[model samples]
Target: MSAPSESSSAPRAVNPVLAAVAWLWVLVPFGYGLYQLLIKIPALFGG
Candidate 1:
């Protein structure tokens, strides 16, 4: 078998704290929107 290629090598690592913050950056607003939807859904259903 041929040796591994550069493109096929393992990917670089990321900072864990930065990753967590990036995820929260996206997820926090999504979570808040979901929470607001849950609060409004019952109003739409009339109960």
Candidate 2:
């Protein structure tokens, strides 16, 4: 026999505040990187 694992537990509801924080954590860096890429793109094309 095997011991029960975390994935064997029932699903839980996500906390909205935590979800928002997680999104911000991911998006802030992504937005900054995208902004940097956009600024460089024009230079790449010699615009």
Candidate 3:
């Protein structure tokens, strides 16, 4: 384990599928909330 740092200084690549899933996990609820807020904006001001 200690010898790993001595091998190279290259950055690790992220898994594309994992990155997509992670982004979806964060964006889904955020998108839903934004959609709901937009739907409610007209009623909030008596449109």
Give the alpha-carbon lDDT of every model.
Answer: 0.90, 0.91, 0.88
Those runs of model 1 whose alpha carbons end farther than 4 Å from true positions after fitting are 1-12
Assess every candidate by TM-score. 0.61, 0.61, 0.62
Best-first order by lDDT: 2, 1, 3
How does candidate 3 fare on TM-score? 0.62
Q: After superposition on all CA atoms, what RMSD does each candidate show versus the true structure?
A: 5.0, 2.8, 4.0
What would the per-residue lDDT of candidate 3 be over residues 1-47, giving only the tens digit for each residue? 46767448667777799999999999999999999889989987898
lDDT (10s digit) by residue, model 1, range 1-47: 87878678679877799999999999999999999889988877797
Between candidates 1 and 2, which one is better according to lDDT?
2
| 2 versus 3: better TM-score goes to | 3
lDDT over C-alpha atoms for residue 4 of model 2: 83
Winning model by lDDT: 2
